[model samples]
Target chain A: AQRVTQPEKLLSVFKGAPVELKCNYSYSGSPELFWYVQYSRQRLQLLLRHISRESIKGFTADLNKGETSFHLKKPFAQEEDSAMYYCALPPFLNAGNNRKLIWGLGTSLAVNP
Target chain B: NAGVTQTPKFRILKIGQSMTLQCTQDMNHNYMYWYRQDPGMGLKLIYYSVGAGITDKGEVPNGYNVSRSTTEDFPLRLELAAPSQTSVYFCASSYSLGGNEKLFFGSGTQLSVL
Candidate 1:
């Protein structure tokens, strides 16, 4: 079974401060990692994916296979960036290719102004 | 398009009562999922469907039931509501063609059992 671990339950940072949301995974084979964000009273939406390697909303995450980690980072935190972040990974292969996601507990980011 | 829509944004069910949470997607996604979100638990998959008439159990499916009779609708059924079942339920859909797997979620249904 694949597992995703997000060490921080809550991370509070001041505006303009650097932000890093740690995420670690335990999967033997190659994995696809994703970061999803949920705003207050809003539906969850994808922020970025490791395979795409494209930054969205000034946030980027690099996959490190050696360390088995894909940490989300941003140089400057904005007040509007405050939201719940979840790291997710899908199992390599399955019979029907369900591709269900294994999710992290999520980190609550509070960007204080 | 209403990517994914879940009905009854909020509901309160007494113990032993039964209810069905309706979920429908207009994206024509091949995969549909039902997940329960609890504090500090992230999201636990309760049921999923690969397509119409094909349903499978997920990580946490003991207290829930689901059926996918059509490609667009996947409703979750709770035979007997319990206090432990009180949580936010989310419906999501995805069009997975071997890659680029992304899930589009609904606003979520908050169910409280007392």
Candidate 2:
């Protein structure tokens, strides 16, 4: 019953404008969340993790427990920032203690000049 | 460092045919994973290995098999290929466990089943 939802499949913004990509999750316990970005023809890579509390590529995400949300935000958008972004939670823990990763559908962010 | 490598950048297989998707990592990561990405579906875990000779199924393991005979290699096998199996397969590796671990992914393999 653990799920991560990225409501926006695509979002567009002008350069220098602020942008936010929403992510929400459903879990019973404290959750660790991460933001991953995939550029055109490039491999997926970790952009940031809620635990690090550090901004990467001018992007930051704050994990809100009450609303069960971890939204990625940037103060100013850049054309190079345009890509597919996904929110993820480590997969559910099984009896054997093995866990996989759960990924959201992802949001395509377009930063237009 | 070739963090993770997946062979057969693209492939076309007919129904009932079989093929193996190769993956290798040079980072000496103990945790390796296989995932299939579909349009609008994100990435779904197919299988994973915690270490050599330790393999387990993920959310979507059906129609796929994996072997982790060495720490640097993890190959996914697809037997009796079907239309549903067509997807972009990605291999990843992480050095640690828990949510803090950062996963490094390969370029990915685009597979098509006719």
**RMSD to the hidden true structure, all candidates:** 1.5, 1.5
Interface RMSD of each: 1.9, 1.7
Q: Whose DockQ is greatest here?
A: 2
Candidate 2 chain A: worst-modelled 10 consecutive residues by lDDT: A91-100
Clashes of 2: 1
Off by over 4 Å in 2: A91-97
Stretches > 4 Å off in candidate 1: A94-98, B97-100
- Model 2 residue pairs with clashes: A91-A100
Interface DockQ per candidate? 0.62, 0.66
After TM-score superposition, what is the CA distance of residue A19 in candidate 2 from its true location, in Å?
Answer: 0.9
- TM-score result, candidate 1: 0.96
lDDT of 1: 0.93
Question: What would the per-residue lDDT of candidate 1 be over residues B38-96, giving only the tens digit for each residue?
Answer: 99999999999989999999988988999999999999999999999999999999998
CAPRI verdict on model 1?
medium
